[model samples]
Target: MGTTTMLVQCNCFDDVDVHANSVIGWQQTYDQLGAGHAHTTLKHLTAERFQIFRETFDKRIVQIGAAPAGRLCLAMPVCSSEPSVFQGKPLTGESVTVLHGGQEFFVQSPGGIDLLCVAVDIASLETFASREFSSADLCQLSRITRLDLEPAMIHRMRKHLERLIDNALVGEALSEAELEEQVLEFMLVLLDSALEWSVGRSANSTVSTYLVKQSQELALANQDEPPSVLDLCKHLNVSRSTLQRSFLSVTGLRPVEYLRALRLNIARRRLRSTETEQLTVARVASDLGFSHLGHFSGAYRTLFGETPSQTPRAR
Candidate 1:
C-alpha cells in the first residue's frame, strides 16, 4: 500500500478500545495500522484530530466550527502497560514517543479509559502556515517546542487552532508562500502549549522528548549518509535496544526502515504530485538515497501500487 498519511485527522483505533499509537506515513496512514506504542490508562473524552487528519489533506471539506470545538488540540504519543514489539520481540516499559501529530496526553480513568488524540498533517500544516511565517520558522515550529502553559497559553492555543480551521475551509485565503508561515507558527504555538500540559504526566517525560528531538536531528544530520543502529546509540547516548524500542513504539518503523521509508515516500510524492514541471524520477530517488533505480522502482511500485513514470495525472 502507499504510505498511509492522514494529513489532519481525529479518528480512533478500531473498537475504540485500543491505544492511540504512531501515525502511518503521509501517503498510506489508514491502510496500515498505526505504529504500536505503549498503552495508557487515560480516558479521552474525544479524539478528534485522529479522524480529521485523514480527510483534511485530501481536499476534503471542513465542517463548520471544528476549529472552535476546543478539542482540536495537538497530540503526543502515550504508551500504557501494553505489549509492544520493536525490531522483533517484546520488551517491557510504559514508554512514549514524540508523535509528529502533537503532544502526548493521558488522564486517569475511574472505570473506563479514554484516549483523545489530534495531529496535523505536516505538509497540510506547512501549506497553512506559509501564510503567516517563513519556511525556516516552520521548520523550527515542527519540532514540538516544549514549554509550560498557563491559562494564557491555553487561550493562545485555542485561537491559533481556530485560525487554522478558518484557513483550511477557505483555501489560499493567503498566498501559498504565506500559508507556510501561518502553519509553522500555528504548530509552534500548539507544541509549546502541549509541553506545558505534559509537565507531570510521567517522570522523565522529557527523556522521550529529548530523544525525539535528537533522534530526528541525527536522522537528518547525515541524510547523505545516515547512521547505523550502533552509530545512533553512540552519538545519542542510548542503548541500541533502547533506541530501537523507542523508534518502533512511536514510528512503527525500525531505524533503517524509517530512513528508507522516508526516502521512498519523498520520491513517490514528488513523482506523483509535483508534475507541474517535468521531474526526473531518477534524480528524486537518488536524492532520497536510492542507488539502484531498478531496485528502487520495484520498492516504489510495491509501496505505492504504481510505477514511477512520466505519466500525466493520477486517476
Candidate 2:
C-alpha cells in the first residue's frame, strides 16, 4: 500500500482530531479541562509507519477505542511530571507503554504536557516477522502486556522520529517509502531486543471479570446506541462464550440482560436530569436502543422498581 500521510499544526483542540482519524480504523474522544488554550502538531509518516504527535493542552482526559482489530500503540511522554493511566495501570513519563487494538483505554494529561506516541499496524509487523525472522508466532504483539522501555532507547527512538519529521518537512518525497520501511524495521528490532517475552493468558485461563468490566465500560460509553453482543465480542477480541461467562460471573446477568439494565439506568438518569426535560419516556427508551416501548417500560420497572413514566421528570 502507498503511504497515506497528513501533517497538522494548530493551537486549537479541534485540530487534534486528525490524529485519531488518520489511524485508519479507530475511534477516540477527548475531554479538555481547565481554562488554558491548547496547541497540537501531528504527522502521519506512512500507512503502517508510526504517526507522531506533540501537544500542549490545559488538563485533559482522552478515551480511545481501537475498533480495528489489528494494530498496536506505543506511547512515551516527553515532558510532564504526572503520569498517564491505561486500563487502571499507571504509565510514567520515562517508560514506554503498549496498548492493543480492539480495546478501550484512557490517557489523562495535565497542562503543558508533551507526549510522543507511535502506532503500527499488526499486519505490517507480522509480515515483516514472517519474511525476515521466520518467527511469525513469536511476534505475539497483541497479547503482550505493556512494557517499560529504557530511557536511553526511548530518547533514541524519539530523536530518530523527530529527524524523520524534519526531513519530511523539507519536501523529501523520495525517501518517504524508505523511511517508512526503516521505522518499522527499527520498531521490530527494538521490541525483540528491549522487551522480555511472555505468553499471555489462554482463552481458557482468561479472566472473565476483567473482560466483563471492559464490556461494561464500552457499553456505557455508547449507552445511546450500545453495540450488540457480537460487536462487543469483535471489538474485545474475545469469543461469545467468554463474554457470556464473564458477564454472568461478574454481574449475575447475561450480557444482553446487563446491557438492558445499563440502558434502563441511563434512561432513568436522563429523565431525572433537567437537561432532558424535553425528552419523553418513549423517546428516551428508543434513544437508548430499545425498539419496543412496552418491553422497555416493563424492563425499566422491573429493574428500577418504577415504570419509566413514574420516574420524576425535570421541572
Candidate 3:
C-alpha cells in the first residue's frame, strides 16, 4: 500500500520486548539475555511499498520473529560486539541475509548489535524484475539466503539506507514519488548484487532452532502460569541438561533464566498497558504466578531497572 506522504518514527525503549514490537511491518520479539539496564532504539521510514529501519540493541538479546508477509527482507548488521548468528549462520560485516516473506528467523547477539534492514513488497519487486530478468533468474533471486559482499559494496548500501532514513526524519527535499523511485532503484541494485555475489545457502536441517521454537511455544501457551524449567523439560521429553544446552545455545539464557526473564517482560508489558483498568503491582505480579510481591519486585527491578509500580505511571 502506498501513502501520499512518508511516515517516519524514531523511538527509544527501556524494554527489549517493547523495542521488538516497535519495528514497523514485522512480527518479532526481543528477549534480553545480558545484564544491565536495557537501552534500545528503533528508527523507521515507511513509504509506498518499501520500508527501511535501523535497530540498535545495547544488551545481549535473542530476537525471534518474521518479516511481514508479501515482502522480501534484506538485512545486515551495521556493527556488533561479536559475530551475530542469523538462522545459525554467522553474519560478518561483509555478509547480508535475505529473508523471504513470513519466514521465521532467529538471531543471537553477544551484545550491542546495530542492524540495518529493508523490506520491499514482493509483487512490486517482481513487476520490476520481469522487465529484463528471466523467470529462472527471479527464482534464483528468491532462493538466496545470504550474500557475501566487498567492504565497499556494504558501505555503499549502508550509506543509501542511512540517507533515506535521514531524509525522512528531517522532511528533506525528496518528494514522495522521488523517494519511492529511489527505493525501487535501491532494490534493483540489491537484487543485482544478490545475483552477482556467491549466495550463502541454509543447511538442510536446523535441529537446534526446532527445539528452541518448540520450547518457546510450550512456554508461551502457559504464560499466565508459566511452567518451571523442570515442567518444560518434562513436557518437551528432553533431559534437563539437554534442555539447558538448547536454551543456552539458541538464546543466551539458561532454561530457567529465560522463562523467568520472559515472564518478567510480559509482566512489564501488562503493567504498562492502559487498557488494564484498576491495575496494581500486586495484581499484575499475582496473575503472572508471582506469589510473593517482595520477590517479584526484586526480580522486576533487577531486569527492568524500575519497580512495577512505576511501570503504569511511566506510560
Each candidate's TM vs. the true structure?
0.31, 0.51, 0.60
Which model scores highest in lDDT? 3
Candidate with best TM-score: 3
Task: State the lDDT of candidate 3 residue by residue for 1-315, as single tens digits.
Answer: 334456898899999988887676788888999999999998898776788889998899999998788888888889888989999999888888989999999999997899999888788667656543558887888788887777788889889889889766876525554455556656766676666623432212365577678877877788656665545655766544456567777787976678778889988887777445567778878787776687789899999998887675544
How far off is residue 287 in model 1, in Å? 1.2
lDDT for each residue of candidate 1 in 75-150, tens digit (9 for 90 to 100): 2222223333321222122221123433332222212212223343455444334443446655665563232345
Q: How much lDDT does each candidate structure score? A: 0.42, 0.63, 0.76
Worst 10 residues of 1 by lDDT: 56-65
Residue-level lDDT of model 2, residues 99-176, one tens digit each, is 776767677664445666666666766655443232443555546656566678778887876666665666643244
Better of 2 and 3 by TM-score: 3
Candidate 1 segments exceeding 4 Å error: 1-206, 310-315
The alpha-carbon deviation from the true structure for residue 288 of candidate 1, after best TM-score superposition, in angstroms, is 1.5
Candidate 1: how large is its RMSD?
19.7
Q: Higher TM-score: candidate 1 or 2?
A: 2
Model 3 bad stretches (over 4 Å): 1-5, 197-315
